[model samples]
Target chain A: MPTMFEKIWNRHRVLEREDGQTLLYVDRHLLHDGTAPAFEMLRARGAKLRAPDRAFATPDHYMPTDTRRVAEIANPELREMVASLTRNAAQEGFTLFGLDDARQGIVHVVGPEQGISQPGMLIVCGDSHTSTHGALGALAFGIGMTEVAHVLATQCLWQRKPRAMRITLEGRLGPGVTAKDMILHIIARIGTAGATGHVIEYAGPAVRALSMEARLTLCNMSIEAGARAGMVAPDETTFAYLQGRPYAPADWDRAVEGWRALRSDDDAVFDAEVTLDAAEIAPTVTWGTSPQEAIAVDGLVPDPAAEPDAARRAELTAMLDYMALHPGQALEGLAVDRVFIGSCTNGRLEDLRAAAAIAQGRRVADGLRAWVVPGSAPVKRAAEEEGLHRIFLDAGFEWREAGCSMCLGTNGEIGAPGERIAATSNRNFRGRQGPGVRTHLMSPAMAAAAAVTGRITDIRTL
Target chain B: MERFRPVRSIAVPFARDNIDTDQILPARFLHLPRDADHGACLFRDLRGAPDFPLDRPQWQGARIALGGRNFACGSSRENAVWAMHGHGFRAVIAPSFGDIFAQNGLKNGLLPVRLPEATVAAMIARAEAEPSAELTVDLQAQQVIDADGVAHPFEIDPFARRCLLEGIDELAFTLSHEEEIAAFERRIGRENS
Candidate 1:
């Protein structure tokens, strides 16, 4: 009754120390601007990359998303930083998706889209959202810069095995609730640090029923819950998603056979298990700084004094203060100044489609700036081909190229001070959108609904 | 690569919970060179307030920071730790820390001391009461010495403790096993061949 995580982990183990640490071979290393330091460290040390073939590079985090020329990078230091990444990737012989490359996008999004993230693989990235690749049945997680350099110098990393936790999503989702909502609801049920020191494998009828993009979205935010990683077992759905992608194995049938074998035993046991009824979940929104400070659209902002734990109550008080929210106030119709429908968490094609479906033949509310950024260049091309871009543009939303824009305020995309934004991004941390900018995390469709109404509104009602 | 040694320094208390990396060193300032003076940017949004501990004259040149639970609780950006280090902080005492932040802190030679919530709260209260009071964190003995001469024992992973005391950076330690790693790779390569 071994869990799928254990099975994959056991296969990748190279050496085990007496202290219970294992040296596991990493199959792929996804790199982006956040990891430029690793290359700099390697260069400073005069060390050569040990396994360049296993590494992939891109600069999604630092690049301007609006087709600004590289020379127009206003900050000279940032321009140098982006240029050094391209130069280092070329010198190191790692496959790179520079800004001009058609394949350029967020590393987490591009990896799965290009089939570089596959089942039974051990993937690591410098970015915390690396857990998104686990939807393909891979054991993936974010590593710090030290680990990134270690992986670059050696295709292996030292890891203490994490305890297994199973989060089962039972039954079908209710109407208008999405994978984003389900994850938000889960984080709310379990506080931000609830899943610390564990690797979670999401299972059950509801999880298996989700599309590949939705499953990726579910795993993407696992870090927010403090889990080292989150994964879904590969099935026919996973195989079909990987079949024709650029980097998929040429021997497709054989690859599927191997992937078919990747599953937990029928009676697999976990150290902890939590079950959620999909029908109970709603279109969720965060009311406070942390992702866990969330509630359903119809729910009220929590009163901190009612909280039993003094520490949590204090945290809640701080969140309520920073978010400028009052106790017992209804969350619906809270005015928003901006709406961002992008991020590795919700910038995939399906995510854009959900937003476009709500935006089609509608106009954005006056004084609200709504922007739609596709997850990858391919996702951008596909959305344009299907006129999803036209729908968003027609609705008065700014349709932009692919990059991690506004999800983080770096790269010249920041909200003004005190501006409140309805965001489809993963984090709702205080000032995450911009300094003094309040963020309400929601699904893309919900963000779209808010964009059209200029306030937080339930997509179901719309 | 400086080896951690015993230090007794005044502790500046900032008791905010879940002070995420965004607040530690906002993404806007991360574009500056790593060696750029991030001390000015540390808590840039909250620094100017007279009530803020770091802005107070009594806490100037303090080498310790006391905070509430889940300190440094967001992104794996090492800049948060670097900024604190740049501000001359050697240790951050908290009830808890984000896992990634703790790891990054250890890598950067900054100590992230985890203590029980009440104990940390008491320490913070003491620091606030006596701004000139010094706390001595003994890495070798694994204890935090408070103003009342009480020693609070803290636990650390044995391996991490060794790394800090010996100044053994991750790269040097990882490269030490190069032969073993190369041999293992060769063995696997042969099997595939």
Candidate 2:
């Protein structure tokens, strides 16, 4: 009766303390530019990486999307962060995807693309979006800098086993409703803390029907819902995606044999179970600062006065004020100042294709700033080969290089203060893109639709 | 890491839910060194505004914070914990927290206490109404004593509680078990082969 999570947890268990905290052996440790502090900790402790071969490093968070030259990063401090990762990787023996490398991208996108993340592996990174790797059926989660140091020193982490939750999506999703919309809908229904202290296993027909890229997008935002991790059991679709990737197991048949057994038992019990109708999901967008304040594209912004709880009413009022949104304001036709279509959450090749399809014959609204930054250099190259860049460029959307551009605005890629943005990345927190910047999170197609109309227009209507 | 001792100090109430790490320490300041004074960056953007809670004279130098549900929700940046600890907050009382942030807090000797929603709300109200109200949090006893002298019990992982109480360095402790870790690795290597 063990679920997929239990199976992976058991396999990784090295030892359990009397208080029930288990030391789980990590199979893969991904690092990014922000990991300089962890390396510094290792230096301070006079320690060396226990398993260098199991770790990989890349520079993304601080990378400039406009240039490949590290010196062109502008800020000396940010340049050092990117350079430190390269320096640390050379000092310690581990693979480093440097700025000019075609393989360099957001760590989440690069992991799946390179096949470093596999079914049943215990993968970890210092970034919260590490949950994105669970799309490959791995027990992946994010860690802090201290935990990153622990993993670097010992290749293990102490974790209290989180309870298992299964979220089942039934029926086929309606056209124009993507995985981004589905996850946003789920977070809105259950609230941000709905899955706290639990790892979510997505199952049922709709989950199985998603492409690997779509599944990655869905799992990428699991952290946004307060879930420790999110997973979809490996199946034919997963096998097909990883078949010829760089790091796929050499003994393909044997690996597939083991992966086929990675699902939960038919009668397995879960700590909690939730079901969502996929057909009911629509192209959704956040109306407030928090991700939980999402509604259907056709819906109006909610009025805070209608909320009964005093605290909740206050929160809604504050969020509305920060977003510059009015009570009961129509989400559609709300003018947007910027449109960003990239990030680990929605910067995959398929995501770019979705956006390109919407931008094929349409021109971006006059005076609107729109950009399509590919998730990785490989994604950029592939999109260029397919003429997707030409389509975006023809439609007046700036075609930029890879890296996490405008997602967290850490790379000097932020909208102006008080600019309302239609973003395909995760998180709509206050001042996330920039100080006083109002962000509306949505799917790539919806973001593209907004770019064309210069407002928050529903993709279906476009 | 310093040993987590009992803290009795005036509490600051944020009176908001889902206050994310970005608000605690903006992404722009993430590249700063760990030793930098992060206290100055705490709620940097939100501060200086009219009636910002952290800027209020009564809440200055508070060592404890009372917040609503899902406090420190987004991002896995441990710097958020550092910002709070650097700002003289020894303990935070909330109904829930982001998993990564809570773990980061324990490793840094900043105690994260989970109390009932209503109980926390009452404490927040009390702290806000009475600026001089002080709350005591005793890790060893696993209880929070409010200004009214009512002790509300809370639960934390036993292992985490012990580590915080003794100020144990987790990396050092893990490294001490090197032999067993190697043995376990060999066994897994054999099993996979």
Candidate 3:
């Protein structure tokens, strides 16, 4: 019985070496601003892109969220990174979504929004969040710069197959407990390294009921759990989402016929299995540096002394010290200095809708800064057309241009040192937002609620 | 890629779990050219701290590192490996590593040696107790010779081992099979259309 992963893996197999590494052909290669080094490597060895038609480029990592003009990027070095992608894309014959293009956005967000990511395809990017494409039933994972060069030269990569894990979510999620909460809850239960060396397939009733956008959010954080990739089998919901997008196949019906068969067999066996109760999951939030150190919004901070293992106890103490949180402190009612509601993880139209619903009548708390950066240019236009931007602007939130903003702060959109922020973006690592910045990760709705109250307010309470 | 050679040097122990790529090389310096010396940027944020291990003079110029579980756990930035290599680290001994980081390390000629958690913990203890204690990481032998003279074996993919040992360029090797790739592409084109 072949699982969905095995079927896709077999389809892309070019050849296998004696060392158990198989060379898999990449169907779609997504590139971003951070890939200048890869192009440099290709040039160093006098190599040309083997499959330019299969590649797409965009400026994301180094793009300034404040403006779209290349000249206004402030830093000459950062401006060159964005310009380099355009230059490389033109020099080679690949499609480029430049800063001025309406389709331009975060590479991960641009992929699915434009329908370049589809069912049963093998996709790759230089960013770890490339796993976000697996929501469409693709076998996608991140690669390093060297692998990026190898893929450019050969359109294939050598890979050791990872074991498959099936995480089945049973029951139904409660109100205000979104897909972001579901994933945060999952990572909290299984520590960051829990799914190391495994590709996870999310299944069961709760997964099937999620919308395409929600599924993308669920899979986006798969890297946080150390999974090679995360996937959900393509179904009617997936077909509907990809039906008429820009890059959907011309032979749509034929493509659907093939995509319909992309699923695990009835007797498919997984190397590991985990079951989560959807009803038990709450609107979750991270109180510490790691995503695993999360708890229910109404819960208290974990005390390191309760951890019997010395190593774990020390890690907890360090995390607490960095976060400036104390043992047994309540997560609710903690003051926030900033609130950010956007990223590839939760920057879709649906996410903005959820946030707008909460900010319709409420003003942001005084002395606090809040921003709503849409994920893509398309998402920004859609939100504006629906008057969601007005809701956020009226609520005292800055409506910014699309690109990765404040997620990793690479483009200089960072919090002041020691500022505590409620963020809908992934990763709460120390200095992720800036040196000495404290980030508490939560769902968009929860973050919106926190913004209006000037504290970490549970969405359900609002 | 530089050919990997066996290394024997004092091991610096930073026994923190989940030391992400951000800590190894912060995102700020990611735009620096590939040829730049990244050694100074290694642990750039944590370097000046009083108790930080790398700041200790005794472990200066250490070529081997002992780390806790899930070392280099986040981000796929190859710069992290470059930072480690630039800082004169030839090998890292850890219980586990981020999948992409391990791959990046092997491709860049920096060995990532996975040992048992307890074994790594013991090595960290020994390294901390005796700063002069040196360990040898023999890739060809597939063993990590601890300071106690105990030889602990490790596993690595044979293909990776051969490449690292011979300084093989993977792109060149893959390009040599141009005929097979073209044939496969033609077949896929027919099937899709």
lDDT at A238 for candidate 3?
A: 99
**Tens digit of per-residue lDDT, candidate 3, span A76-111:** 999889889989998988999998899999888999
lDDT by residue (tens digit), candidate 2, A195-310: 98899999989999999999999999999999999999999999999999999999899999999998999988999999999999999999999899999999999898899988
Q: Enumerate the candidates' DockQ scores in order.
A: 0.53, 0.83, 0.82
Q: Against the true structure, what is each candidate's TM-score?
A: 0.96, 0.99, 0.99
**CAPRI tier for the interface of model 3:** high
Interface RMSD of each: 1.8, 0.8, 0.7
User: In model 2, which regions exceed 4 Å deviation?
Assistant: none
Off by over 4 Å in 3: none
TM-scores for chain A over all candidates: 0.98, 0.99, 0.99
Error of 3 at B108 (Å): 0.5
Chain B TM-score in each of the candidates: 0.93, 0.97, 0.98
A399: Cα error in model 1, Å? 0.7
* Pairs of residues at least 3 apart in sequence or in different chains that clash in candidate 2: none
Between the candidate structures 1 and 3, which one is better when assessed by DockQ? 3
The sequence of per-residue lDDT tens digits that candidate 1 reaches over residues B1-193 is 5898887999999887777888888888877766789877899887886667887989998999999877887687777888898988888999888877887888887999999989999888888889999999998999999987899999876777788899887677768888888887788677545
- Model 2 chain A worst lDDT run, 10 consecutive residues: A96-105
- Chain A TM value for model 1: 0.98
| Lowest lDDT 10-residue stretch of candidate 3 chain B | B169-178
